[model samples]
Target chain A: TQLLEQSPQFLSIQEGENLTVYCNSSSVFSSLQWYRQEPGEGPVLLVTVVTGGEVKKLKRLTFQFGDARKDSSLHITAAQPGDTGLYLCAGGRTNDYKLSFGAGTTVTVRA
Target chain B: GAGVSQSPRYKVAKRGQDVALRCDPISGHVSLFWYQQALGQGPEFLTYFQNEAQLDKSGLPSDRFFAERPEGSVSTLKIQRTQQEDSAVYLCASSLDLGQGVDEQFFGPGTRLTVL
Candidate 1:
């Protein structure tokens, strides 16, 4: 079973639309990270949330960590075509070198 | 390279053939990791190395898989007797060290292996 679960396996929206993606798990994580991957490239780190109830924003993208650290959400406002790609959430634990990843959400922003 | 670099961005091997994928992590990075990713799925942990020591390898799928980093820099993942099911993208990542709270892992473009 995938330790981390991302909802809305595939998302397609207009260029100006807003969208949200979720990552859930039963196990608590010390830190959770959001990454965006483009075709033929590696995933790039977008943000990291280490504290429960933390909310972080980068431009139009907002990331929130749940109070229990077992869930996370990414919201994009006024999405652009550049936002189209696979969005992955990875959970990490203290002292553990391995990251548990979710089966990612593929977001396609139509131009 | 400023970031992690992987060799042979794409590889095609016949069934029962052996293949080797190489990864060169960022300079001075102490942690190196290997992961396998199937289409439409997240990358799964395969193995990990700290410096030149392999601290964890519990995720290796089978005995045919082997990895090594002899000099604490470059790493190689070798698979023997490849099967069609072994086709996937192999990714390599590197981090400065085990993070106290947050560690950022920089990933390579990944090697796409196709077993026929």
Candidate 2:
């Protein structure tokens, strides 16, 4: 069973539009990470949030960790064609080395 | 520096045949991980290694799936009996440290396995 749930299994928006993807779970985690994956390749880390209620910004992308640490969100401002890919959220526990990943949201930005 | 790499980016196996996938992690990385990703799904953890020790194998699907990292750098995943259901992408990741809360896992391009 998948431990994390992501909304809007797929998202398609035009260039310059804004989009937000959410990851939620009932179980709390010590850390959460966001990754973007392209076809025929592995997922690449975008950001990691360790504290609850923490918001991080990477250029035009914004990431927020829920106060309970059981959920997280990723928002992209002015989406571009280059931003098209699969977005995945993974949760990590205090002592466990394995990560539980959400099914992921496929985002497509059209020009 | 070079990132993690997997050999034979694509593999095709006949049903009931055995196949082996190899992963070479970044140099000096202490943690290695294996994951299986199905179409339209996120990668699922398969196993983990801390140095040369197999720290966790709970995620391994069955005894048919076996992994080893004897020298702590190069690892191999072997499937004893390939089945159609075994088709998926196998990814290898490595981290500089042992903990996941603070370290970033560098992933390889992955090996796509197809069992007919």
Report how closely model 1 matches the true complex, as a DockQ value: 0.68
What shift in Å separates residue B42 of candidate 2 from its native position after superposition? Answer: 0.6
True contacts kept of 2: 0.65
- lDDT of each structure? 0.94, 0.94
Report the Cα lDDT for residue B24, model 2: 96
User: How well does candidate 2 score on lDDT at residue A5?
Assistant: 97
Residue A59 of model 2, lDDT score? 98
The per-model DockQ list reads: 0.68, 0.75
Tens digits of per-residue lDDT for model 1 on A41-100? Answer: 888999999999999999999999999999999999999999999999999999888889
The DockQ value obtained for model 2 is 0.75
**Relative to the unseen true structure, what is the C-alpha lDDT of residue A84 in candidate 2, on a scale of 0 to 100?**
100
Tens-digit per-residue lDDT, B1-116, candidate 1: 69999999999999999999999999999999999999999999999999999988999999999999999999999999999989999999999986333689999999999998
* Residue runs of model 2 more than 4 Å from their true location after superposition: none
